[model samples]
Target: MKYWLGLDCGGTFIKAGLYDLQGNELGIARRNLAIIAPQPGWAERDMPALWQTAAAVIREVLELFGIKATAVQGVGISAQGKGLFLLDRQGQPLGNAMLSSDQRALALVQAWQKAGIPQALYEQTRQTLWTGHPVSLLRWVKQHQPERYRQIGSVLMAHDYLRYCLTGELACEETNISESNLYQMARGRYEPALAQLLGIGEIVAALPPIVGSAEVAGRVNSSAAAATGLLAGTPVVGGLFDVVSTALCAGLQDETRLNAVMGTWSVTSGISQTIETGFDHPFVYGRHAEAGQYIVHEASPTSAANLEWFCQQWGMHDYRQLNQWVAALPKAGSQLLFAPFLYGSNAGLGLCASFYGMQAFHQREHLVQAIFEGVVFCHMTHLKRMLQRFPHTRALRVTGGPAKSAPWMQMLADVSGLPLELPQVEETGCLGAAMAAMVGTGAFPDFTAAQQALAPRLESVQPDAQAQAAYQHKYQRYQALIGALQTLQSGHSKEAL
Candidate 1:
């Protein structure tokens, strides 16, 4: 039987899966990588360390399955988005990889906005101008490190860079290239005008050629085979940003279906037959695997990441214990509401996390519950906007780290007023990549066929009416808290007079 490989490169770890044509799992391996947070609002990863760990997991998965590299049909890769990886003329990494969450580019973004580029930027990129974008960072680099910037010959996203190492080819997939702020979403290519407007026209020269996802860019090289224990000529197919891969894994190809990937951050995505732009629905839109299709997605920058911060502040050990503690709390525990915007939000400006009705009597569980509730509240806001855009959504599909917990899933269903379907395998990103590779190399006819043949089991979670009703009341309080926070932030700015 033929086999395929799928790998997911995340901020916290890299996961690999080996599967046969039947979609039955043959083997799986994972390697955790270190996240370097040298200063506030900055997240970095050591490129060498990440590549070494990824290579180790690839070898281990192949060895565990006793598969020859030449025997494998193809490989698919899904990776975290918005990371900046610069390479010199010889393809050597220039500096630490800047994560999607890094905010050092804020000054540059401000300057661009002041120059009256925000609306035009949105028109071109379909993404809000923000500090986390590669375009902003590239401009920042030109201003701060002209010497380092001049040595660059290629710049790729996290997975694109790794693909280069494996295939000895330099190219960026459409979904990823869209994040660079240089991409014209409607045109489906990089915009030279935007680059020139941003005063970083030369930076585009370092970018890789854009390619369609599922295209076989090249075959693995001899050195890669030795390090990864695979056949030298194994084909590598195009994959996408980790979020889109996760959406694909959860069966989000249909225009009426939506997906919520609740991990460190949370994202709500759905397929749009055509790009639609309007009030309060600014989103990052990309093309689907098929020609002439688009994927409309909006993200909440602080979801589970907010929960992690609460746990750390309260000295909790892990999410399970913290979740359990929160689950046991009384209804409307502490009456303390959180806005879920600790990391600033992608939704709108002046939104910040706030604590309403806090008291000295409140305990750690109350705080934890509030954190989770805040995230659910944010998702509900997005869900409302999504339904407005796509009024035909029948059900909601969820997949990610937090989706594994029963209480969290229940809370999501209860809070969002939508039934949730959870896949048996939470590692859908890797599986989706594997499926893409399978089809890209003809192991399967297409995605629909692959889903029926190889997709894992799924279980549905329905909302409990009682809990839903109770959360409904708290949901009102949550909305009020958001408005009050916005008012407070606005008042603070005006008070400077």
Candidate 2:
């Protein structure tokens, strides 16, 4: 049986999987990734360490399945988006990779907003300015670490760097690079004008050549082959952003479908035939892994991580126990509202997580329920925005850590008033990457064929009309709470000034 390898490099873990052409996972391995926070707002990972972890997992998975290196047909990667991975002229990492959650460039983002740089760039890229974007991080390096910035020769995303490490090639994948503010949504390439506006024009030379997700980037070189136990000259396909990969794995084929990811980030996305930049709020517009479609998305760090935080702080390790407690609580009319901004806020970078309307009568169950509801509300915020463009969206395919919970999936369906579909596969990101590899290696004619052959069976969760009504009222309160918080934050900023 011909198999493909898929590597998923996420913020907290590097996962590798071996899959057959029929989408059956033969084996899987994962390694915990460590993040370095040298400063309060900085989040980074040792570049070499990341590659080592990825390589180790790849080797481990192959050994687990007892598959010879030559038996694997191809390899592909799916990784977290918007992180900065810089390489020198000789393809050496300039420094630790800046993660998507890093806020070291927050001040630079604020300065850009104050100077109207974001507004001007949005007109071209249709992407919101964020501290973690390559352009922002590049500019931050230029100003703060001038010498290091000067040494940079290539700027790649997380998966791009991994692919480079494997294939001895340097190229940015489309879905990932399109999320960088450097890529122009309308023009379909890196925009020099946008770089100049962000004051990082000089570093534009560092941008790698762009490749489609299913295209062959390069073959595994001998060094990479020796390290990972993969055949030398095995085709390594251009990979995908985790968002697009997971969406594809969940069977999102066209504009009619939406995908909600409740992982480290609360992400809602749908494919669009044309770019829609008219939204008053920030939404990411990027090229889909499949050509001729745009992945319209809105995301913020407000999801299952909120529950993880609550569980950790309260020393609650058993999720089943937490779910039982949450399920026992009243479904409606809870006075507590948790703004799931523990990492960062959708409203702005300055706002932090908080619980509003907390009363003395609130119990642990109430807080837990509030956390669940807050996460659903956060997904609603993005799904609602995406629905504006995809008015015909009939169903949402949800994938992430939260999808494992039936109660949480029901909450999402109830809150969004849309049927939720969960893929039977656990590692949808890895499966998606494998699909790309299959396509790149000519195992399938195209993505449609691979998807048709490998798409996982899905279980559907329908919204409860009665519960939707209750969430409708509570969602209004959630909006009001957000507005009130924003107003309070604005006032505090003025006071500080």
Candidate 3:
């Protein structure tokens, strides 16, 4: 049977999935990729190693399923957004791949804020200045690693780099690069003035041509065929930003339901036909895989990773037990709150992850409950903003590691007062990448057709009225506490008033 291959390059893992035209999962495989941190606030990966990991996972999935490379008709990819991957003048890995979690550009972001660059460009770019954004990272490199900066030949994101390795092509998929702050959203092209305004005009030459997500990028080349065990002439499509992949896999075809992803970054995304900005906070917009659509989202590095942090520290993995404990607790009575900003902050920078209102009576289980609630609270912050734009949203399609926990999903539902659907797919990224392939290869006419052909199996969660009422009061306190902290953080309150 003819199948498609999808490579999903996440922050810490690279996964491959094999799918039939009917959207049935034929087989899947994954490999953990190393996250190299030579210094605090610096996250890098070996680019060549990343490519090998992609190849290895693809080969393993094909071999494990007893499928031939020639049987795979099309290939697509989705990966973490905004990481810096570069090829030198020699068409080799520049130095090390910088990850989206990397904060080497934190100070540069602060400087930009002081200089009003974000405000100047917000109407055009629609992305907030962040440490991990390619715009910030490029400036940081020019100042700190000038040697490496000078050798830049091509700049791309993780999936874009992997696509290059497989197809020997240089291009930026629209969904990823649209958020890079290099591209002008309304103009539909990269404006050199943006690079010049950001003081990185010299590196604009490194940016590649833009490619649409479901368009054929190139054919897998002979060397890649030998390395990945794929047919040399297999068509490969331009890929997606990981968040877009998840949104598509969750079947977010319109603004009726928001897609909430609770991974390393907590994200709430909605699909719209036109650009909508001018929010109390910055809302990012990305080109959607579907033609004439845009994905508007608010995200941060605050999400399920906080639970992972607690798991690592306390040597606990009994999520079933931990979740039971959380369910048993009284949600309204707990005064405890966690910031969930261990990696990055949505509230603002210079704020660290912390717990408030802890008492002597609070136990480890209580702390676990606080961690879960804190992450949900952070997501609510983003969700509330999204709801302002998509006011008719009736439900939330939630995805990620935390969605598996009943307590967590229910908490999100109660807090948002919207029904939530948890997708059963093991890897939405891989599936969405495959959907792109399906559309590119004419298996489906467009993204909407692909969605109808492969709707995800979903489980639902309804909000508890009592819990919603309680959370309403608790949420006020939550906002008050965040405002108090912000007053202490910047001597100015974050109250919406």
Model 1 misplaced regions, further than 4 Å: 278-280, 309-320, 347-356, 487-497
**Residue-level lDDT tens digits of model 1 in 222-319:** 98888898788899887878777877677776766788888766788887678776667566777666566677777767678787677667777677
Error of 2 at 121 (Å): 1.7
Pairs of residues clashing in candidate 1? 69-231
Q: How do the residues 105-208 of candidate 2 rate in per-residue lDDT, one tens digit apiece?
A: 88778888899888787777878888888888898999999999889999988999999999999999999998898888877999898888778888788888
Give the lDDT of residue 284 in candidate 3: 83
Model 2 sits at a Cα RMSD from the real structure of 1.6
The global C-alpha lDDT for each of the candidates, from Candidate 1 onward, is: 0.79, 0.87, 0.89
> Candidate 3's residue-wise lDDT over 260-367, tens digit each?
999889999999999765657677888899988999998989999898889989899999999999999987568887888888888877667888999999998889
Candidate 2 residues lying further than 4 Å off, grouped into runs, are 277-279, 359-361
Q: Pick the winner on lDDT between candidates 1 and 3.
A: 3
